[model samples]
Target: MSAIARSTEPRLDSVTCASPAGLHRMAYWEWGDPDNDRVLLCVHGLTRTGRDFDLLAQALQGDYRVVCPDVVGRGRSDWLIDPAGYVVPQYVADMVALIARLAPARLDWVGTSMGGLIGLGLAGAALVSPALRPSRGRWGLDATPDVPLGRMVFNDIGPALDLDGLSRIGSYVGQDIRFASFQQAVDYVHAVSQGFGPHDDAGWAALTEHVFHEQDGQWVKHYDLRIAQPFALQTPDATTAAEALLWRAWDHLPMPALVLRGAQSDILSAETAQQMVSRNANARCVEFLGVGHAPTLRSEDQIEAVRRFLLTA
Candidate 1:
């Protein structure tokens, strides 16, 4: 390949979504045929943008109508009025709105890190009893019933998370920092994302381009710093409760699920990856030997794994 960044382009668009605080616009990059009924929704991790999926999107655009979204508070999306709304439930709600707009005859999901958690929430919500379902008003949709996912690819994430990894992430996520030049910004990304495995200069540049934008003669991180507030406020008890709920959700899912783990990932432990597969009859696990925390899905092997599962499995 000439370079990872050189590929078919995508159309940028936005959908109106609602949260308890008010309405916000969630931006997404659309690839492939807009009218194609086979939809693949790709969601990025905690601080990454929708552009993170550019390579993967380009690879599979012809096979599926790939839609990658910049979850609220990140990328081109609008920031939430209430920082607390940065949680998974809110992300899931926004995704529902996006799904409604697409109205796909078939839908699949590929989520990395935080994105995986949001996918889990959606999968779980589909199995909830009618009485337990959230009101449509809460999701900002007048009629968004729980739509079943055809297949789900959980990229470097699982129901239970490593606290140490979370601590490491929190240490720098919302830091107030600016870069003097593009190379400086790229260097900062490399320092923080050593877990993404190996990539060349062009690969690193592709990752940094959408994450930082020039403002007032300085390069600043594109996401809202306030997005970290909820993470900092999380307590052990809350985390335990959330994990239990996620496990409950994971066990109840009926759709085929693919769990991708970075062998060295601190966030998704090997034990949890195995548990994820064992708990669900339709779930399976795959690990990338040298990767950690998450896989960018840009490499040939990573992309092929996802393609085979989503297209054939």
Candidate 2:
């Protein structure tokens, strides 16, 4: 892919939203025309920030208003008062408030990992009638008119996640680590994020720049360590229950969906991707070879796949 022009900087914005524990401000990076009605919401993966989508957003901004949010407890967003509030339900609630703020006539979603689960929840909620919605009050979403997801790009996630991948991720997700210098931080990021596939020095450096912040003359990861509480506390029964709910949500998504998986991904396996397409006629699947866990949408091939899916009539 071509390098993102230095002039195509995103505007930073935030909105106040209610979580089960309390209220917090969710920060988002907006690209292109704010007045543009075609809003595309791009959410990041676990421990990642909205800046993760910088390349993708820059590529598509001319065609749509791209909104990338730093999900609560990560990036510039506020950390939750309670660690338990880091689950999907709370994330979904915050997103509902964000959608309300955007008030777009048309909306599309691009979600990576945890973000995909949120998209599934939003799309599922839009499809289910209020009467049939579970007691969580439509996944804690307010009674707003249906704002269906026009289309979605689910990057390296699905209802059935590989336990091995989950374990590998949990092993390091919330660890508190510090670096004495920017180079040290970048090196650390590269060590932990090898699953993001092969990227040259420049690509890896770009990724590291967004994930680490300088604090007290030292560099540290951007997210709160407590963001891993939910993962740490999950029981096998809870996992089974969550998986069932996710499948139900996946089944309810009526919009056309694109499932992008890393060929070597331990999370969303090839079998799971096939199952997703089989269950939902509108779903299509694509795989990127030589990648694992996730494909950073920064590459030319990856961006092209997403652009064609989202821009197609």
Report the C-alpha lDDT of model 1 over 145-230, residue by residue, as the tens digit.
45445899999998999999999999999998898899999999999999999999999999999999999888999999998999
Worst 10 residues of 1 by lDDT: 131-140
Which pairs in model 1 have colliding backbones? 265-293
lDDT scores in order = 0.88, 0.86
How well is each residue in 1-313 modelled by candidate 2, as lDDT tens digits? 2222222788899999897778899999998877777789999999889999999998898877889999999999999999999988788878878877776767889999999998887766656655222232122334444444578999999999899999999999988899999899889878878889999989888998988999999999999999888899988899999889899988877789999999999999899999999999999999999998788999999999999999988
Stretches of candidate 1 exceeding 4 Å from the true structure: 1-7, 129-147
List RMSD in Å for every model shown.
4.0, 4.1
For model 2, the superposed segments whose C-alpha errors exceed 4 Å read: 1-7, 129-147
Q: How high is the lDDT of residue 294 in model 1? A: 81
Report model 1's TM-score to 2 decimal places: 0.93
Residue pairs with backbone atoms closer than 3 Å in model 2 (clashes): 265-293
Q: What's the TM-score of every candidate structure?
A: 0.93, 0.93
Candidate 1 positional error at 289, Å: 1.2
**Model 2, residue 158: what's the lDDT?**
96
